[model samples]
Target: MKNLIILSIAGFLLGGCTTGTSITKEGTTNDPKWHKVETILNKDQGTFPNLQSLSEVRQGMTKDQLYSLIGRPHYDDGWRPREWNYLFHFTTPGQGENDITTCQFKVIFDHNMIASSFYWNPINPKNGVCPPNIQHKQIANKRYTLSVDALFTFDKYDIENLNTKGKEDLDSLVRELGKFKELNTIQIVGYTDRLGTQDYNEKLSYNRAQTIKQYLTLKGIPSQIINTIAKGSEDAVKECQGISEKKQLIDCLAPNRRVIVDVDGYIEGTPENNPAIK
Candidate 1:
């Protein structure tokens, strides 16, 4: 179904045809067709409703199975592997249909069989929040996903927990970033262990993130260039054991007590203004 859609659009564009009706996986519809077609397609996931799970969307399937499972591709971009994209609206403008949203998926084929696949519901994703605007980067003559992580601590934590040695190390990092002129955006991720209740943990995480931003500002890093986030105890350490009955939960979740800072932007060459941080 997806491949069909892509083919439909490409043919329409190349031929400069303005057919009163546009053909889509959900069948055919007239101008102002997107909403109606999307509604019909999502009626029950038009292409491959039964093969719902990622596990079920296997890497290899006989042509018969592919047809029965996912209808004919509406669009196939043929990117290295093949790409089939389907568009559907889970929501309509009427009442707040939060449950009714839109989504997309891509299936890549190697030798006409699935090689890799991805499903996305961009309303919200797990990899933290994303900025409003982003432009992808091209690295090594090929496209790549760029990501970074930043670590921040308050003066008190640096003094008591991290000790002077850690503070000195952080100072070096600050200098390195201060001298950095290649990046455009910086993301500061903050974390707080479960030492306290959830509410306190959230506040603590926010404060820690702010502390880093403040430090960066003092170093003349500029506030507008940085974005901050707090993860709290969500990503707790997985390698550690449970804290003793007498111990605190925060201690047990200490592994999650860290932040990730990412800086993105153009380096020396290339097209410029490419988003770096993922």
Candidate 2:
């Protein structure tokens, strides 16, 4: 009995040591499951439950039920413990754009460990019932942040002539904004690259934020619900140095120019006292 216990302890410690091995393209590690997962993610291709199977998933299903219905989940403990996540990717080498979608299903269990309430993303499932009044999952505070290059022209910040890519990005954001009902304040903070003088940058950043507020207000968000701030050249996410060329440097510091719209308040439909509110 003593020798058997010692062998089990040694085996557990050995398993812990293998978890840190760096994933590689060539399957050289002793862990095959970890290697397979890494390969799928790295290459952006993998198998997941089909939409037909996913449609059968319900709000009150147990973890065991979920496993039975969809085989094993793609084991990820990074997010909430009770949340079951799945990523479905369909691709044909010569077919249309790959349809990659993410689905997150979270179950809140009662004292008896049975599922009580639930929520999920991809809200309107093609064949399944919507998870009984889905609510915006909170993370301390809700923030809708985006870089300036992702919303406006290279150096300009006008809503009328927003670039094609920017328009698509904003459309997605607007859809999410429509989901929330308890928006106390929506702050729009603008930043700029460190190319111009501090005074010039400050004014430019402020103008960008104001324009954003106007755009949002035009889209039905109340003007009073919005706040604007100008970060100017401060807090640059990227400091592009060495290259002294005028135009080249500006392109490199694109990430520094950004505008973040933060929505401060609780979302509608979610339980106020839910322990998973973090």
Q: Estimate, for each residue in 125-242, the C-alpha lDDT of model 2 and write its tens digit.
A: 3333222222343312467777788778776877775777777766777777777643445788999999889998998899889887887787767675578999999998889879
Error of 2 at 183 (Å): 1.5
Please report, in order, the local distance difference test score of every candidate based on alpha carbons.
0.43, 0.57
lDDT comparing candidate 1 with the true structure:
0.43
Q: Candidate 1 on 1-278: residue-level lDDT in tens?
A: 99999999876565331212233333222332112234333345433122122123444554346556556544333333234445422211121233223334444344444433333323222231222121222211111111111233331322234444445555665765644322345677766655568887677677766766676687666575567777766766553555566345434554566656665432233333321112
- lDDT (C-alpha) at residue 191 in model 1: 67
What is the number of backbone collisions in each predicted candidate, taken in the order shown?
23, 1
Alpha-carbon RMSD to native, per candidate: 14.9, 17.6
lDDT assessment of candidate 2: 0.57
